[model samples]
Target: MSESPISHLKFSTILSKLRAGINASDLHGSLTGYLCAGGKATEDTWGEALALDFTAEGIQDNPAFPQFFRQTRAQLDDVEFGFVPMLPADAAALETRAEALVDWCRGFLGGVGLAGAGKRGNELSADAREIVKDFATIASSNLDVSGKEEDETALVEVIEFVRVGVLLLHSELAPASSPRPATSPTSRSLH
Candidate 1:
């Protein structure tokens, strides 16, 4: 797979500096899920949905965060299926990457719920619902594994599944011309 447009370590460092209290993988996952659920791609909408303070000092001035945000949105909107979840580099420990995947899944679930997918359950096609369920299972699963070749293979497969599943969800729920509801602060909270 091609390298993710956003580097996990670099983005994490930026978030830490800004005191965002969220990891890069989780934040990217949430952004993907929010878009998949038809949320607007505006910075304000994203910040509100995630309860992040983009107005925080240095947040707006920092070019990296905004660049990452735009790149993520572009990837999802790309016709070439360029979307990829932000995670540790391949050189990182396998266990660390697995844990990041778990975090990503959890963030995705939260994001979808925040975007009102749960309230629109009947609107979701069977495949979308199944994808959500699978994501939930992955979010809750125990991913610990010894550093074996098979474990590496399995992780890669799971990541691919997640990448495709996100694209499918985006196409189904947020078609390019579809009219999406405005996400207000009140509506952004996950119940």
Candidate 2:
């Protein structure tokens, strides 16, 4: 029998689904840090690219800043997923460097059918809202949000929106390489 919608439902389940099969070692603690802080995500191949730290931990300790960054490196030591907003300074810095990218992402995904046109701008739609409520339980399989609040709706929307933007850019900016046979050894390789 097919799985019921309830069986497939995922309200606050972001980490488990998002980080499933993701290696613990591959989850890095920072991106900009990897770029400037002498740190790097685990792995050296495709996995490495995905092992980035989305959480702005540095800004969390301060209050003069507004929230900037969200997301974090999945932890193998524990199991859970939660949202963490970056401080204003960190957010400002990120916004400065990736404002265009962020804007493009917001625009790209805003219309992809995630965010609504009503009161809850960042909140999920009625259909998706239920799924978001159970996000915490779902993400608990691949994340570590021991001390953070369980707020996956906004984070989920933000990430999905950004993903859409990135995907759109890829479709438009990525060079069209010659198609290779599926069975070719190099078929899966990326330049």
Candidate 3:
């Protein structure tokens, strides 16, 4: 399907709407459960933080995509973000920097993939799900997922759910283009 003419709408707005629609209380409760179940490193906290931030901030900058970066940073912070306590060159900072790069790349790719899918249609496509899966994989790889860890699986699922949910919400909220007026000077010009 042709891309909807919803140029005036912002993707951030759509994401916020979708996040708001979700059961936050339920999500938080679930996260707590996961955390109690040894999923300390799960991304649920980060996802919650980022989703909240997105709702609070909306889209500050559109073309520059600062909202996206800012929201991404919010999520990153929950993961001991950017090596918080020290300046660059410290081991923690170095790890944070590396992680940030990976996270940013994954986030961008997921966003782009979602946007492409949105342009194509309203319904979620397999390709779109694959893109989200790729996002989850990237997030999972950040930790030790090779050992059959339950925490890792839970974390990845949360991240993917948030990503997909955000994309789906944004597309749903996009506004249809304004309808053009029915009459024009040319229409009345005929003698």
Clashes (candidate 1): 0
Query: In candidate 2, where is summed lDDT lowest over 10 consecutive residues?
Result: 182-191
lDDT of 3 by residue, 119-186 (tens): 44345444444444554455445642333456445444544444333333223322121122111111
Overall local distance difference test of candidate 1: 0.78
Candidate 1's residue-wise lDDT over 128-178, tens digit each?
A: 677778888889887978999999998998888788778777777777623
Candidate 1 vs 2: which has more lDDT: 1
Candidate 2, which segments miss by more than 4 Å at Cα?
1-150, 178-191
Span of 10 residues, lowest total lDDT, candidate 3? 182-191
TM-score of each: 0.85, 0.20, 0.23
Ten contiguous residues minimizing lDDT sum, candidate 1 = 182-191
Predictions ranked by TM-score, top down?
1, 3, 2
lDDT of 1 at 60: 76
How much lDDT does candidate 3 score? 0.33
* lDDT of candidate model 2 versus the reference: 0.25
How many backbone clashes does every candidate have?
0, 17, 0
Q: Number of the top candidate by TM-score?
A: 1
Clashing pairs in 1: none
Tell me which of candidates 2 and 3 scores higher on TM-score.
3
